[model samples]
Target: MIKLLVVDDSPLMRRLLTEIFSAAGDFEVAVARTGAEALDLLTAFAPDVVTLDIHMPGMDGLACLDQIMLIRPCPVVMVSSLTAEGADETLEAMALGAVDFIAKPRGAVSLEIDALAPELVDKVRQAASARISRATRLRERVRARTGGAMARPVPRPRAAQRISVPRGPLPADGLVLVGCSTGGPPALDALLGRLAADFPWPIVVAQHMPASFTGPLARRLDRLCALGVSEVVKATPLHPGQVYIARGDADILITRRAGLLTAIAAPSDPELYWHPSVDRLVSSAMAQVAPESLVGVLMTGMGADGARAMTELRTRGGHTIAESVDTAVVWGMPGALVAADGASVVAPLDRIAGELMALFKA
Candidate 1:
């Protein structure tokens, strides 16, 4: 059975969460009424996963998350609300090492909490199975933060660096499409950091996130990467040396105008599971660009959103890549691609950027 710790300030919430986990029969639940208490229980409980509340009387979820990472380094799933503030905190929590989040339904009461039992249980299971290296690193960072230990120098902005333009004419239809969910933020951060600022192909990214969170994510990436990164604006022209992130509330479509590709932001299809859906992006790219000119990458996520389209891309001569299972936080998205024989390359997160560059070179 998976061992879970449910931390919240509300006694009712704690009890409800515990009952849900207990009912699943697959989890052994431990309860804490606050972050401080959760920290205290970390040693004795030794939980495989934790469900953390964002707001508590003292030492909120973020603070608790920091402590848990430093002290135990286990999988943490944040319990958040669905409001804009909650979305922002959820993204921040994920960046700091939470594997995922469960958005509390409106009106935080026992009934509402109980209503989400299945989802909460599922997320706990996923968290328990997630790769923990990132969490371990986060723990070390927390230690450094508290101890004033030496840390890596922050990367400087590239404002003064000369931007390299593509040497020759822009490749008629070449494009790089990246899709990710769950552990996407850090994965995107690592991959984008590895690429040169003057990378010569236009790259588009679709990451499952709330609309309120995508802008912040783009800004964060812009600060961490050499390349300019921005949330997609409708009808914006796609250009090399910049990365475009799909707006989380809409699907970003690649459109050709006089042979130049541009992004068109459209309302998300109600039928789709994810806004800014990876499948929608890939399908649109395939329609606009030659198969040989496209490169599709499916990364860590919880579902098979991009697998079928990735397969089609591969069949038509586009290169396809998937994150390797051991390196993925969830492995479901990339695993689906693998199971469908969709990936031309299966690589670890650290190697994906280099692999893409090599493919572009060849």
Candidate 2:
């Protein structure tokens, strides 16, 4: 059974969450009314996973999350509202080491909660299996405490050091296609921060998120990355040094507008399980551009959204990179690609940008 701790200030929310998880049969649930209570139970209860609400009374969810990471780094799933502010806070929580988040239903909490039960249970289950690196969390905490002076260098993975991809000059109009879910925000930050502003290819990302969250996510990435980042809300022409984040709740399709490569937001395909579907993105790009001119990257996400399409991309001479299990918070997406024999390179998150730079070298 999975041991889950549900932290929320609302008695209704706590009860609802407890009932939902308890009904799921495999979960042993515990509830806390405030952040302090949650922290108090952290050591004694020793949960495998935690579901945290952002609006707690005293210490608040973010503060509690910090304490949790510092005290005992276990997988955490944030329970967030479906508003703009909630999106920002949830993204911040993810950066601070949350495994995933479930957006709370809007209006009439009691009535809406039942509908959200399945998703909440599933995210919690996924979080229970997520990877949490205690050393990395502690290093981050130490660096923050010392303001970077006492920070220690992290050793690069041996696999990253020995990356041996064929050196070549990619086409002038080449594009990089990235797909991720679950623990994607931080991974994207790490990957995009490594690329220079003069990167040759325009990059597009299809991250599974809600419509309200992707805009804030794009804005956040724009501030952190050297590359210009924006959410594709319309038919935007692709340009080098720009990263286009697919609008959530919809799919971003690659097409040519008057001979210029463009990305347009389209209605979500009902057949696909995840919105901003990565499979659809790669498949659509392949229709307009040669597979060899595209590079597919499958990062830390749950499920096999991009595996088959990326495998086809590889068969037709394209390059594909999968985030290695050692670094991925959830090894589902990239692991799927690796399982299908689709990845041209399977590297840790820290080494992905280096591999991309190597592939695009002139």
Q: List the candidates' TM-scores in order.
A: 0.85, 0.95
Q: Candidate 2 has which clashing residue pairs, if any?
A: none
All models, RMSD in angstroms: 6.2, 2.4
Q: How would you encode candidate 1's per-residue C-alpha lDDT over 74-105 as one tens digit per residue?
A: 88899888777887677678767888888777
Residue by residue across 171-265, what tens digits does model 2's lDDT show?
77789999999899888977887888999899999999999999999998897778999999999999999999999999999999999999999
Question: Which pairs of residues have clashing backbones in candidate 1?
Answer: none
Q: How far off is residue 119 in model 2, in Å?
A: 1.3
* C-alpha lDDT values of all predictions: 0.81, 0.89
lDDT of 2: 0.89
